[model samples]
Target: MPPRSGSRAKSTGTDFRAVEPAPLILLKGSEDYVATRALDRVKAELKSRHPELEYTRLDVSAATPGELSTLASPSLFGEPRLILAEDLAQMNDTFLGEALQFLEEPADADVTLIFRHSGGNRGKKLLDALGAKAVVVDCAPVKSDNDKLDFLRQEFRAAARTIHPDAARALVAAAGSTLSDLGSAAQQLMRDITGDITAEEVDKYFGGRVEASAFKVADAAFEGRTEAATRLYRHAVATGVSPVAITAALARKGRQIAALVDHRGPQNQLASALGLPPWQLRQAAETARRWSPRAAADAVEAVAQADAEVKGLSRAPEYAVEKAIGRVSASING
Candidate 1:
């Protein structure tokens, strides 16, 4: 994946604004947020160039080659056209031949072709062919903790403001690692606070919900930190995170730990099996060591009971979750 653009504008405050439009643009890889942002940039630039530009969007995965060829062909009105071919990986062999043949000759000067492909080898032949003629921009996922931390810092910095490291960490912990979610959280935090931000300010803005996030609460509970887990649970509930989401997180974490026990593979393979990032796998492995296989199974059963109780069986959902947290904590200790 290509490195994200470095320059920032005062108004847009993003690298996308600096990108010039390309004839055959390939947004490669699986980072949805990044790819979407890049796509927006291209559209914005094109709109700026020709206010009345005609845009023809086609999902190549579904559209026939004849349809795509006609759309990409020169328009009768001579108006500039912006052609978007989404899901390039699903482009059939027939369309691939037509597209490659079209690229062989010079295209209409007024036309721009943007191909969006989520990562995979499904259409490697097409991707390689386009590489010779396309301006490829990588949109790979952010995998490491440090990279995510950098993203948080850059987001704040782009706004001509700064966030304290502890505050940033707390925000990431609560918001989860996905870029779209984190971006939304950052916007909320900025809207709710002014001047330099601190951990206390973050906690206050989120109404003490940072520690109460499902992942944090479950992490504490799974390691037998009953006091911390209970406190977080109360705060999370008070802040309006649904009880269902809370219990669901608990059940998922418990299941991950239980599954880790039965797996006998390298950490990377184990992480892949569990659909977790490497760092998260390490955390789950550490937590798994605190429990016997029987205890882990018991915790999973407790979580299932909590899930049911919170939904309907119990009148007091809060107390049911609290009791489940205690049960799981004891299991970890055992």
Candidate 2:
């Protein structure tokens, strides 16, 4: 029998960290770092109080409605249980109905249910309904460099370690900006070197991730380092770097080169006009020397196309980015 919708309580807010686990939890978003940490915290808290936990992981895609009904039903012994339901988008109609029905009634206080969702168009109806009642945790993906740096700061602080600000940026540069990689790097650094970490230490130890920043990739592409830039692009993408970020970097670099190529004035005046720092203007001038004005225009056009492709206009975003890299490299070298 379906339970009444208004019979059970709704969620107070989206602050999952403070809230005790309600009967339903909707862990939504693409940021694995935030979501995973929250899930771990919940499990740790639950297990600490109840040493013997009845945890069940559900596969809604394959499990029949009958199986789900049996699993979520009140146990005879009334043991505290933790139910984890993943890939909500893949559930069949019958299983979806059964799951929604279960949420209508208040579960035994001891039973906690967590639903893991990787954000997409699928399961919109279920998500909208669950948002009202489920303790919603937003694990939205962190795409910008600054946000990733902030994440590193918090992670390091959590371990009672104070990392220098420059060191945090250095870590992002060296570790490819992904939360998991950054977290691992933080632990490794803290373990190997006692006390506060510095940028020099990050460069010395974890230099691999830093070796391929978006700007560096753009520099290589514009400087006609075809092999090098292409390799860096692949590494960045694999390490969860956003394609949009890469395109933005390329566009910025292209504009700098264009400005340098067209400007005819005192160095300071040109720098002011282009809004580039002295060091950056010098670097752009050097790169611009290698490419003709026509080539610079071509590079700019390529970046624009790549931008469109990555924003969902093209089916293959990664390839589109790579192609843009190749075009820019070829133009500069031409």
Candidate 3:
């Protein structure tokens, strides 16, 4: 029989990191890495409790009519079951009808249904139903540096290890913007290091990678260090970082500084308004201090030209990027 209305199986909008095993779990967001991790946790927890758990995977996009019911039905031996239904965002009409029907009278407590919807309006009806009844785990994209730092901290905290905030920032800068890459780097550090992780340790392991990144060049350029920016750009390009990547970094930096040039509101308010972390806003504010409105405009123009040049407008993309770096540095210095 279906569980009572107020059963413990329902969660009140749980985060991906805090997901618990439930009869109906919905990983609803666009971030596959976080969703996969949450699903793995649920699977592990279920396995620990039911050693002989019958695991099944269903592609809801290709599901046939009544497939979900067939899978959720009791087996002869009555072993617990875990049904991981993926691609809900691309579910067909047949699956959608069955899913809605299944929701009206869900399977027994021994059956667990996990739905992975990677964002869309394709299955809004089913999503609405799951949102009200299932343990909804948000698997939203972690795009900002602040969110990435939180993820890194959680990784260490999960293992009962302490990661210095500076170390976490360093890892984020070194690891690029990919969550999976950052997670793997954190896991490797936790496995290899003995004590609390430090910035020094992070640098020792990833300093070269950081040096080769376009961010280093962009940072130096925005700081008005012309020589350092030029040197870093050359080194980054030599290390296989493309001219396009360098121009992209410069464009991003310019946008950040330009956004804060004339802002007079409270720092936190501005950060929230701009959808940027406080630390990032603080850094941009520091750079903006040296930049007048005209200078910021000039930097933007310079970055735009470089972006065009790198994207096939000019043959000497390397020289174009170097020229853009020099112009940005000069504008900041002025």
Predicted structure with the largest lDDT when compared to the true one? 3
Clashing pairs in 3: none
Model 3: weakest 10-residue lDDT segment is 3-12
How far out, in Å, is residue 305 in model 3? 29
**Alpha-carbon lDDT, every model:** 0.72, 0.76, 0.81
Pairs that collide in candidate 1 are: none
Instruction: Report the alpha-carbon TM-score of model 1 versus the true structure.
Output: 0.57
User: What would the TM-scores of all predictions be?
Assistant: 0.57, 0.59, 0.65
Q: Runs in model 3 with CA error above 4 Å?
A: 1-13, 211-226, 230-334
Error in Å for residue 99 of model 3? 0.6
Q: Which candidate model has the greater TM-score, 2 or 3?
A: 3
**True-structure Cα RMSD, model 1:** 16.0
| Top model number, TM-score | 3
Q: How accurate is candidate 1 locally (lDDT)?
A: 0.72
Tens digits of per-residue lDDT, candidate 1, 54-143, equal 888877766675776688678788888888888877877767777766666556677778788886687677777666557776676775
